[model samples]
Target: MHHDSLHALLVKEKLSLTRPRRIIFDLLLHKDPQSMQVLISRAANKVDRATIYRTIELFERLGIVHRLNIGWKYKIELSDLFVGHHHHFHCNQCGATHTLQANPMLETMIDTVAAKENFSPRSHQLEIHGLCGQCAGQPA
Candidate 1:
């Protein structure tokens, strides 16, 4: 996305484009999505942890990023790329996350469960954890 488009998104979401928030959004746009610790470490200008967390929270609310529950810790990433629906797989060793393009089986399972439990499923997120191919073959 272009800088102008991103800025428009912030405005459409009724969000202010502060320095820290812009940097964080730009980092996610250019680099791979990362955890807060990684983002903070890569920041050129020192940013408070609280500010980072707050920006993340606001971005999440605005649908600019998705806060993924990757089991051990929270992982966030850009979400506007996907058209319909998708899932993710995270490498436990290298911390790399890949978007899964298809997962009909999982969707069916969720639908079945919702029907059996008589609960309406508004939304759901799935994160599978494992070593990526490179990490799996590496010697520890």
Candidate 2:
């Protein structure tokens, strides 16, 4: 997304576009979903840990980022505002996460199930967990 759009989103959300928030937001734009530790390390004391956590929480609440529950812990990533809806493939062995394009078939199935149950579906999250190529190639 463009800088203007990001700024506009902050404004619309009633959030201040502070320096730390802007820096972290820009970092997220270029990087994939990251853990709190990873984000703090990347910040390198440029932004405090509490501020980073608060910013991430605010972004998640604003629908600007997705807080993913990948079993062991939670990860944060830019939401559909920047990229379209997508799934994730998590490598259990290596602890790596890969993005997958949205699957129309799966979405249809979910919608069908919701319809069958007379439930209105707002959104859904799907994560496939397994060993990645490099991990699978290694000795078990």
Highest TM-score model number = 2
> Could you tell me the TM-score of candidate 2?
0.91
Candidate 1 residue runs with Cα over 4 Å from true position? 1-9, 12-14, 46-49, 80-84, 104-109
**Cα lDDT computed for each candidate against the true fold:** 0.75, 0.85
Question: 1-140 in candidate 1: lDDT tens per residue?
Answer: 45566577788968667788778877787444577778878774667788888888887777778877765777778765423467788888877888776578888898889978898887787777888889999946
Give residue 2's error in model 2 in angstroms: 2.8
TM-score of each: 0.71, 0.91
The candidate 2 region of ten consecutive residues with least summed lDDT is: 1-10
TM-score of 1: 0.71
- Candidate 2, residue 79: the lDDT equals 90
- List the lowest-lDDT window of 10 residues for candidate 1: 78-87
Candidate 2 residue-wise lDDT, 11-121, digit = tens: 997767889988888878856688888888999879998999889988888778888887768888999888888889999888888898898998999889998999998
